[model samples]
Target: MTDSSRPTRIKVIRKSMKASPDQTESLLWGDCLFCTDAAMTDYDWVLVYDEFPRTPVGTIRNETEPLLCPPDQTILITVEPPSIKIYSRAYTSQFGTVLTTHSIRDLPHPGHTLGRGCLEWLYIKPMQEILDQKEFPKTKMLSTICSAKQHTHTMHKKRYDLTRYLADRLPELDWFGHGIREIENKTVAMDDYKYHLCVENHLEPHHWTEKLSDAFVAMTLPFYAGDPLATECFPQESFIPIPLDNPQKALEIIRKAMEDGEYEKRLPAIREARRLVLEKYNMFAQTAAVIHNHRETGTIRPGAMLKGRHVLRKNPLHALRELTDTLAYKIRSRGRRGTGTGA
Candidate 1:
């Protein structure tokens, strides 16, 4: 490598938003993404999400490995949730920091084509709903499932009322998903549904996840409640956007779409969306794009985005209590094993 053309080493880091006060490379998610990793490292960016911060930002340079980039020379990239602070100033003061965000709302996001068997089941709710939009059902729309154990939002009562109304007045749309059902194949099951009720857990910008992507991959229109700026993520015509605030209006749109055979009409656009999503907007693709953008701009665009509270992880006491309970249980179990119950 020539003196002028030596690849700039960019080190990516992740901070535990609600827990750790400092940014470490503990890979929570979406950490390992390669921009240009061929024989020659063109982009020369390293995604160190899961790795144990082995190459921290403030390591002292040794004379033996002078070819290795110094911590200060490398740009420290922090991948964090959009709801939390993008980067910390105290950390950036030591090393150049870049911010990256992910659209992955659910873990191990629903991917793969829906199998022919899952024709009846329209949706999957493995995790509990935080701030969800009302399930807008149509005449023939059935075989839906959700797994929201609880709704913690202040307006949860209103949504519960709506569900009650549907149960009494219209029995068809009253199906609610609760608890976990490990279907044999998610793709096979989800593929059969016409729409996936993909109401996000939150309403903030850039806080999107695979709920929308899962629907697209399965060739089903996502009755989306999250991501108001859907146009920016993918083609607007691809998914059926729903009104988050107005239940009646959202239901009307869903009902009209079902009655008018809108899904069939939107098939062409939906196909295009699937292509775009897999090729460009999928989690890996998006991470690659963020890396490329950062390299081209020589920094995070418009600089660091700092400080925002996560709606779900707002309380620290809960985490502390959980940790305490886990420790206590382990200790008690060990003591019992040492003592011996009878024999």
Candidate 2:
């Protein structure tokens, strides 16, 4: 068939087959529909899942398409990795076209290279009223529940213990956990604290964990430790990033700020920072815009392609080698040489 005439396949997650007694037969279908770009074109759209369908009973190839799918009823593409080679052979022989491959990480359109989703919640309310109360302390520190994958058990224990230690050292200070419940409370608690510590575990290139966003959502000043690109993702003045080489100094500054109440008058500016996030990164609106753009354009553009050609021309290999040598030199120099974090 000509490319234009070829059938388009949209991949959707299958739901349970057991009909619900409360609904009409037509309405009783069990499937969660999260729209994907798979069926927008004549090209086959594959839904690759790490887990088996909870309701369907069959090998990936034998699975039947659900009656509730879009009217087009294009082919259902499924593959189990590790055994992906077998599925690949079956797909090529049966469909006469190679299945387009994409990683799950590739799903969320690469938002602004500034990393639009880097902040947790777009809106954080001002806590100035709460901070004005005599009972509420002016000093506070914020951190999140450490994920096991991101930190060693020992590191998690140390950080948690350190939180308690800081709390004990400053009885007037409050310690907030990184939970959905706590994030909800940030609208109030953030007003009282002078500093929010975004102590992330990993430091990957161009990858800053969601903790930075958590801090932003709280509408408090952030003392951060993450990828240097963290600053690129948000306005530079929005955060006070802790240099990897001068962690101790960063901590000291936070301690002093809390002790002296330097952050009290700065609350207005902090609230302004939070407002900027809401204006730029409304999640629902952004998601809808992405979906609409993909539908209109047919294909979502890759994020890496957004970088300037001059940036691509730079020698990453040489930079890596230089970075490795610099790291070695720092390790060897130890306390003797002054070191700084790179942006």
Candidate 3:
């Protein structure tokens, strides 16, 4: 007998193959009690972060292993872009429901019923703390923080090339990130600039990362690329679109926006977007909303397991792919270290 009035206890299991730095318990669990282990029987709910199955053994003690979650007690969230095949698997039977930008087969994101596009997870402060802050003192006009890493993905290469072109063309544009320079924090680095260039690695519809949102939180208008459907997720006027195919045009647009005082004009919209980021779009807020809904309705069901796929086991093809990718990544790492640049 669980008390419906009490905050639900949630166990957030990381299922993404990529290793991430540890996040605070409050950021990870929101209003819910943070359950450290799925083995803990006292936990009220389990939230699988990106239910991808391609993971090596003994990595974080096989955290990607599938869980036997009851329909009402499990939730899956996919923050990875659809471009990455590893995170694209539909673990229909593994989790109760999913929270993602794109539709996972016929699975409706439980958070969408509350409000759409609240799937993003980031290191964010409380909403009121963000809203109460005075505007950042801008000392620079336009700048960008981009990595120079080259990858097999066409979009990644394009980003690298575009960054080089922009750096060469705009002498005034301050560039940061790996290869060019490193910053302690992106939001802090962006705060001093009136506008920041932020481009997603992949340009898929409804797929956006912290790139644009980070800029908004820094109160910097973004000269953005990728995610044609960005307006569907954020306030339309919060960012200015720069086409990926045209660096020259992007440069011109950046110049014109700064000249026209676009940052100042869009300041209100940017502030609104930041509020949305902290309040609704963040992982904590979204998880809390889902817990609230489940507490009220008590009708959500766990996903149906596919016969052989429901259990976590080694997939031969996936293993071979992982091996190849690992080798490639090691080679890339060595090369990056040798050159002191991702280029």
Candidate 3, TM-score vs. the true structure? Answer: 0.73
**Candidate 3 local lDDT, 233-343, one digit each (tens):** 678999999977788998889888988999889988898887887677766677777776664434333443321222343666645654554354445444332121122
TM-score of each: 0.49, 0.44, 0.73
Q: On residues 106-132, what C-alpha lDDT tens digit does candidate 1 reach at each position?
A: 111121111111111223432123013
Candidates sorted by lDDT, best first:
3, 1, 2
Q: What does the lDDT come to for candidate 1? A: 0.41
Candidate 3 wrong stretches, greater than 4 Å: 15-24, 27-41, 51-61, 64-69, 88-92, 103-132, 295-343
User: What's every prediction's RMSD, in angstroms?
Assistant: 15.8, 13.6, 8.0
Model 1 misplaced regions, further than 4 Å = 1-44, 48-145, 151-185, 291-343
lDDT, candidate 2, residue 321?
Answer: 46
Clash pairs for candidate 3: 71-301, 71-302, 93-304
Ranked candidates (TM-score, high to low): 3, 1, 2
Give one digit per residue, the lDDT tens place, for model 2 in 1-343: 1144422333332333222323211110112122232122222233322222344332221233322222222222222111111122222222211122212221112221223442234234333432233343444454333322222311243344444444555555555545322545444545455566665443434444345554555566776666566555566667776654454565576677656664565666556555654444433223223323333222322321111112222557644543554454335334332111111
